[model samples]
Target: MSQSRILVTGGSGRLGQMVLDQLLHAGVSGIITTTRTPDKLGAYASLGVDLRHADLNDPQTLSKAFQGADRLLLISTDDLFSGRRVQQHTNAIDAAKRAGVRHIHYTSMPEPEASTAIPFSSDHVATEATIRESDLSYTILRVAWYAENPVELGLIPAALRTGTWLTSAGAGRIAYVTRSDVARAAAAALVRDKETSQIYDITGPHAMSAAELAAALSRSVDRPIEVRQVDDTALARELVASGVSPQLAPMLVTTDANTRAGNFERVSHAVQELTGVPPTSFESFLVKNKARLLGATDK
Candidate 1:
């Protein structure tokens, strides 16, 4: 165990895998990645990438995972609204400090400062505050909305099925960030010669309204689409009814409220400076994923 090792939690996730790939592409040495299920990451293991099953929820597992790592990347768990998730982060932070990890990089939301409406942001802000007060050096990447988030999970599927992108973001403008940019920025921070222990707001190139984004998607997919505002309360209820868990409803509601309040609009230069490339444009995303996105329509 040496101080040169870098440990990345959530290493098997889409964004984490991208970070791992970029790191391997750079031939950076001493990278360690942890997953809840190591078997699924056999591809990475085959490439001689260090993989371990270390669930942050377990204190003992987290302690072992944090061992010998000079820097840690806490990619924030996806358990959207559980208090236990926040507690899991607290455990990781505690374990990292105890292990004498020099630095930590945490992925957070766009405007944590203005995201009081969102329960998720509160957790993010609390964890960030804890990091600042702790002796261990820390860097927080408050990322903007992922361009892929909308297309992959939130809107595109529904838009394709119903010809409308329904959301609560009434007139809010969003600067769509990309997961690849987040990954690249993370890799830079992990391998940089100098430590960056401050908060960096990573964002995409342009800001657009929900209507504008829907128009862009329609143009890309060659289909007619409309952006419609949905009731946040009803959406929450539907999510709960559809087995999204009652605990998560508030988080979704708060997030949509934040969106409606225009908290996702801020732009920043951190991505370009950190990754040595500008964040991908929304149009670029459509171009790259058009085939997959429009496959259903084409068939």
Candidate 2:
């Protein structure tokens, strides 16, 4: 059989870059990647990845970018809380079908069909349904929360400053995996020859509650932190007061609701199964990024 030509969308983004690197490390050639700003991906172009300009919102660019691709990685966009994201995803899927892409791998959130508590779940659910209804073979990778997201989201710093982390997700457990692990899994799925449609819930090894997460942060930063439970409305109000975008506050608030409902508590070995390595743990991630988390200039 001929080798597959892989096309990865959003190749300059965090997760997409990692996936591209892993595919290269696995010795897979004929790789293609798409980005709106191709100049930003000079490193990838140097590595022989066919870097093409494609915008999910612009269907005109997708078909050409997807040409000759045996598999396509439809990395979901980061435009949360906007209704346009779903439409953009649908456009990509339609274009991939038109381009004769055989298999499509999509990065999606866990239990999108059942996790109504998360405002963005409907978008992923809709996208997944579209991929399923199409003629292409598909792999649905339902990713868990990123272990580093708490620091990036300002949750850890907020807990450090206030000595309390207010949350609506009371006693909710999350199996937070890393973006690197998810990317590796995506690369593995792309290289493997799977004849049938598949769905994998890629997650960390274990689940922990908000209190546990706070304790882990405290240990990493060497500062005391506390978890304070609050209602969704209160959390949303606090987030807005803290300068979070008013449009995004509600979605964050509902994420807590979803967590509290155990929607994110599932732990899976999909990462290990796919990449042959266990996913990174939350504590290890915190320890590795302690300096950055503590506001230090260097590690």
Candidate 3:
């Protein structure tokens, strides 16, 4: 199959780095990767990747960096609290247009417009609009909550220590997809010979509630973890008291609120359809990371 120069923005990021690896594993060449710090991607450069320095905050950099790229993967920016994420995204979209990039790919969350809890959801809503309004052939991957979110945030560790899994989701369920799986699906979309305007909701096979997830955590860590549900306000208060920063506590609380609103309760075949392989189960993901979550084990 012929290859076009596929440019992956934020190539040094967690998801973007994984997408680059998947692209290489697929033997897809003519790859262009952009990050703010090009020196950090020495390994990818060694693999014949065209590394460029691009910053979403700087439109001129992006315009120059995206040159000659047929496809572009705009991994959503990570400025959760800055409130400038949408503007940053717009800069990239405009840069892609200036560079004349044909197809654009985006990573987004599910039901952003319906998300009353997450203030950042509007950022995605605007980004999607900008992408569509650009008239570029695009693929939007509405990725679900990452299974690693609990672990990446301080939640899993706190729960394991206190034997109390705290949440404000009530009975809300979410299909938490893994980061690698999301990355694979995004990569698969970019490399396809038939690119078109499409949106795919990438989710795990099963929708699980906080209790179910707590049970999984209990089993993984070999401990009894009891789910402790509270109101969103109370949860935020407790989170801040437990050492979470005031800035981030609200965002964490709202994830549960959004879940309660049924924004994330979904199960889809998009991952399997895109990658030709069923996404890994949540149980499998926990088992694989149990060691890390558990920290040191008995020798």
Candidate 4:
């Protein structure tokens, strides 16, 4: 449904920035973005996008920022170490409800229950429950693993540097979709007139296993990546040994475990259905990011 305004939480992050771009490109009007650091969104403001200072961490600030918004896009929080991811999401959902948002769109994962390995996944499950419990119109975009995860999570760089790709996800395939494709899907859902309660599994066109990922990266970066399959514990230790924070290591470990269990094996056409654009392939993402991936390894 068309609305007077739409609000996006966590607007300063990478995915949020891309979602804002998609919304602007779609000619979406009355866009409001919330971030703890509003000054960081000056560029968005320059483009006539409404910017507001609202920290999901601080529920008090959200009331004002969430007000005047007819629709809302609740981006899941990434505050893994804080032990407050669920509470933060709850705060945003409550604020949106009180602000009288008619419809809500959320960026979730492919299977909420399948994220048992991922400790932070509770936040997504909890937020979805809260949104549904509120009896508001909602669309949950179950965004699959990002195609850029290897680079985003430092796996690509580390692999390139060490010539080894370590994983616990043996023969498990993940339908990794690009962040931009997920953003486009979110933007499309935000502006659509549908008020139905629904969920869309936003995934890439194809699924690939860890070994296949290594091969793709090898070709893209023109380097040999030796795939080493290890248990979850060993994977965690390796990540920590490679400079990953001790706290973040566990979450990474569980992500692989979840994949190994086939939790992320679902490949859906929801991205194209929602955005009217084909989801970018993981191979294409690697090719496009070849330069940046190599540069990160050098660092």
Candidate 5:
């Protein structure tokens, strides 16, 4: 197989970093990554990755950064609150087309076309449409929720502290895939040979409900954790009280409401098929990050 000159945006980000590492490990040569600040990515440069300055909000930098790259991993920017993320993504797509990029692998949400309940889904749906219209061979990776989200956002820690997990998502199950697994899938897709646009629902092997998640947390931490389902209004109030911004509280509540409506219940084998490894389960993720979940510092 001929090696594709790969360029990845958001390479310094959480998931993007994982994708970069996976590409390097897979021996994918001629890899390039773009960052607004090249000095911040000196380590990647030392590893022989071509680091360039490219900002999604700045269209002039994108074409030069994408020059000579056949495949581009366009990691979606996390500017949901500003309502300009879709525009930024469209800018990237347009620049990729102008630079003659052949294939684009985008990180999108699972089944964004099915629901308008998730506020961020609109950005992804619009971006996917733009990519389709760009005449580029594309791979749309519809990723599931990350297992690390709950732990990183203080949800699990709050439950551990209060002995109760408060949720507006009643009886809704999510097939949570870890960030590492998603990155691996992205790496696989970037190098694979394909003639047509493909969409992959990158999800975990199975789905688990809120109650099941609480029970798993209890078992992992060796404590009793209770599940409390509340309405969106009550959830929003609690979120605000817990230091979440007043403006963002309602969005979080809506996320749970969407979950309860079963928008995140799809499970898929795409992770294994793409990365040659099964997606990590929620139970295993919790066990692996037990110290972090239990508020213990790494030694």
Candidate 6:
């Protein structure tokens, strides 16, 4: 039998919703999900999910939400761009420890210290360390690139439309895992009894570069799209001009450099091994989201 009760925090988030759905699909009956705004979680409510009101920033609220839960899915807080996000994560971890949760499942970045040089990566890296050091059984699900990342929908499509894909990730490949795949892996880990201190680098099968992705989009949309390698200085300028934080400009540049350096270059079999199904491939991802992505190509 699964845990008596499985509690998922941030259940309303994109990945969180998928995790919740997969857990229900897996026949886990006693599922408890927490959201800051319970009223907004109408769909989950209709599914007979016990909704608890709790903000990740407040340990008292988290403790109440986590009580009586044998398993806890600590969906990483979405306030990465905010200044207080790290503190918010600390508060949630503290509450999990206080509640004596049996297993703490964390949704973390894949090589947060190395990927895309985003500021959030540092936060995830620190959180992973905190989870490891804490006196609790933990499963670290280090997620690789999410195929549905905004870059896929926004910048990539925009670049395709203009017939110009500009980035410093020249020929660098990444195993872009889907949100569903990551969710499935996390849900699978939650239901299983594994030794503590287990770390799984969840990734997809294929590793494609920006140029290759551009080619895929071109084929999908029936257009000629070209990938242009922009220098770090130009990349920083473009990001800043696009209203991206000046503070984060350097981070993006660093990330592009890391990509070129082949940081996110590995494909992991963890997903297939854990879920008994291969993780979604980048081509499959492009096919499914072809509408959303190609929709932008029309404009």
- Every model's TM-score: 0.87, 0.93, 0.95, 0.94, 0.95, 0.90
Task: Tally clashing residue pairs in candidate 4.
Answer: 2
C-alpha lDDT of residue 123 in model 6: 85
Steric clashes per prediction: 0, 0, 0, 2, 0, 1
Cα lDDT of model 3 by residue, 113-232, tens digit: 998688888999999999999999889899999988877666777677667888999999989999999999989998987777999999998899999999988887778999999998
Residue 34 lDDT in candidate 6: 91
Comparing 1 with 2 on lDDT, the higher-scoring candidate is 2
Ranking by TM-score: 3, 5, 4, 2, 6, 1
lDDT of 2 by residue, 111-171 (tens): 8988998767899999999999998899999999888766666566556666777689998
Please identify model 2 stretches exceeding 4 Å from their true place.
239-251, 296-299
Worst 10 residues of 2 by lDDT: 290-299
Off by over 4 Å in 3: 241-247, 296-299
Superposed by TM-score, candidate 3 places the C-alpha of residue 60 at a distance from the truth, in angstroms, of 1.2
Each model's lDDT: 0.79, 0.86, 0.88, 0.85, 0.86, 0.78
> Any runs in candidate 4 off by more than 4 Å, and if so which?
1-3, 240-248
Q: Write model 4 residue lDDT over 151-266, tens digit each, in one string.
A: 76777777888888888999888899988898888988888887899999999998889899889888988889989999998998997777566765676677788899899889
RMSD over all Cα atoms, model 1: 3.5
Q: Could you give me the TM-score of model 1 versus the true structure?
A: 0.87
Tens digit of per-residue lDDT, candidate 1, span 62-159: 77777778888999898865677778788889989988888988998877868888666778878888888777888898888788765444346546
Tens-digit lDDT string for candidate 5 (234-276): 9878866655557656656766877888889999899899878
Winner on TM-score between 2 and 3 is: 3
Q: Model 4 — which ten-residue stretch has the worst lDDT? A: 243-252
So what's the TM-score on candidate 2?
Answer: 0.93
After superposition, candidate 5 runs with Cα above 4 Å error: 240-251, 296-299
Best by lDDT: 3
